[model samples]
Target: MQKSRLLMKFQSSGHTTAVLRAMSYASPSSKLKDMTSGIEFYDKITYIEEHFEEEKDVLVQKL
Candidate 1:
């Protein structure tokens, strides 16, 4: 069964929330062991946002 259909069958909000939390715990993105890596990712995106006007939507390249 598709996840969306499974989610929709829940008539109770509490059950839905519990299932969603369980699914979140099981997801791959929840496995980041290094907190600093998340902070670095945030810093990178903010740096790009601050410089977006200068880049003018140009493809960012790594040197």
Candidate 2:
């Protein structure tokens, strides 16, 4: 019933392509939608990367 077990079953049955296709069309659950606000996953990654870059530049300038 777990996600990994389900995925393994699909893979063992050679239904990986079908599983991928279904997942590609699947939408986020309402719970997930309701929980999300402000920056998204990739946006958060970029925000952190940019912050680190700024800090690195400041450190380099001080050295």
Candidate 3:
């Protein structure tokens, strides 16, 4: 159960990172409109990646 939970969290974090990466390349007007929210999402991804490094590292290795 704990392993499944960790995997779920790691997958969600990866999705969050993908969204932020997309936002990082958005058009200037869209970026300006959403920059603050995008930053928050990015920060959340960083926090999760830092706190759950083991799970994240496994995912990275698999990919």
- Please give each candidate's TM-score: 0.31, 0.25, 0.26
**Tens-digit per-residue lDDT, 1-63, candidate 1:** 333333344334556445544554566553242112233334455566678787654645542
**RMSD of each candidate relative to the true structure:** 10.7, 11.7, 11.1
For candidate 2, the per-residue lDDT at 63 reads 63
Q: Whose TM-score is greatest here?
A: 1
* Candidate 2 residue lDDT tens string, 1-63: 233454454467655434443444465653243223212323443454568766777657766
TM-score, candidate 3, is 0.26
Worst lDDT run of 10 residues, candidate 2, spans 33-42
Which residue ranges in model 3 land beyond 4 Å of their true spot?
A: 1-37, 53-63
lDDT agreement with native, every candidate: 0.45, 0.45, 0.56
Who wins the lDDT comparison? 3
Off by over 4 Å in 2: 1-39, 53-63
Error of 3 at 61 (Å): 24
Deviation in Å, model 1, residue 19 alpha carbon: 27
Better of 1 and 2 by TM-score: 1
User: Could you tell which candidate, 2 or 3, scores higher by lDDT?
Assistant: 3
**Model 1 TM-score on a 0 to 1 scale:** 0.31
> How high is the lDDT of residue 2 in model 3?
39
